[model samples]
Target: MTTHHPTQTTTVQTIFRFLLGGALILAGTSHLTWARTEFLAQVPQWVPLNGDLVVVLSGIVEILLGLSLIFLARQRVLVGWVVATFFVLVFPGNIAQYLNHTDAFGLNSDLARGIRLLFQPVLVAWALWSTGAWAAWRRNK
Candidate 1:
């Protein structure tokens, strides 16, 4: 009887995942502390919660997701899906920042903010690709 071992993630994918995780951790830390006020620019005014509370909560969630990305290789597919969903869920904030002309993170002009909005999908793709979620999903289908 043969016991099958899951294939290891490639070196490039591992490195990219780590980089993404590190970026998430740093950004999450900024959300809770130094960049709290700056993050407010992304919060839609229509949101019922206090902006600070939203930032803090999201920061905690980011830290958890980032850590999972770094440490949970066996569960990478699920993590990838969750991370992609997270990117989707938070996209409105990016749109709000662009529409409201809020200056944060040095994204002062509408062009800059609009450009920033374009990167969210890239992040979603990164999460899915780096973790092999897209490939796994395709293989299963």
Candidate 2:
């Protein structure tokens, strides 16, 4: 059996995960405070709930996702799924921002928002790797 050396990858992954998690937490916290209006403006008109409530709920979810990313190791698969699901769920918000000509995460231009959208898949990949799904993929292939 070949032993997998997760040392380097783990170090890099831990650093990335920590940063990503911290960023999300900060973003989520703002939804509860300073940036609430900005987040509300981005909410699609089609969503059934009150915009403020939605923002708060989304903030809660993001906080949970961030916490899970930082604290949940053995349940990495679950964490990965949460991150992936969050990405999918928030995609429409991104599209809405693009359609309404609004800035994303305080970005200045449509081009910046468009560029940031490209990272969703990369984040999904990172979530998967954080869960060791990449290792499984390599081993299976």
Candidate 3:
């Protein structure tokens, strides 16, 4: 008897997933090193943790998430959900930067910061779409 297996993803999805993974890796590295100060500017001042400490910890988390995105295809759906959640969680920091008028990463003006805010949802969608998480969830439902 012969058996057929189901395909999990399309070529385009795989390409986008890898691209997202690579981007995440680069962003995470910057968070830890060269862009550390810029990342601090995004932290909400009211956050109890020291800004530097928060940046360092979040950088570590980003690195791990990037690695998971790249090497954990079998678990991509789970990773996607986690990554999307992370993006949502950090959104308040982005808002705080805009509301507080903090300048960092060249987002000096309100227009620049406002434009940046629009990309967060895109990133969340990218995580779900690239990993087929959205499709998988719908399929289960």
lDDT of 2 by residue, 61-110 (tens): 88988888788766655676678778788888877877787864676688
lDDT of 1: 0.89
Q: For model 3, how does the per-residue alpha-carbon lDDT over 7-109 read when each residue is reduced to its tens digit?
A: 2777798888888888888888999999999999999989999999999998888888989988999899999999999999999999999999999999999
Q: Using lDDT as the measure, which candidate wins? A: 3
Return the TM-score for candidate 2, rounded to 2 decimals: 0.82
Cα displacement (angstroms), candidate 2, residue 32, comes to 0.7
**Model 1 Cα lDDT, one tens digit per residue, 24-140:** 899899999999999988889999999989999999889988999999988988898999999999899999999999999999999999999999999999998888788778767
Candidate 1 stretches with Cα past 4 Å from truth are 1-8
Residue 67 lDDT, candidate 1, scale 0-100:
95
TM-score of model 3 (CA atoms): 0.94
Q: By TM-score, highest first, what's the ranking?
A: 3, 1, 2
Provide the clash count, candidate 3. 0
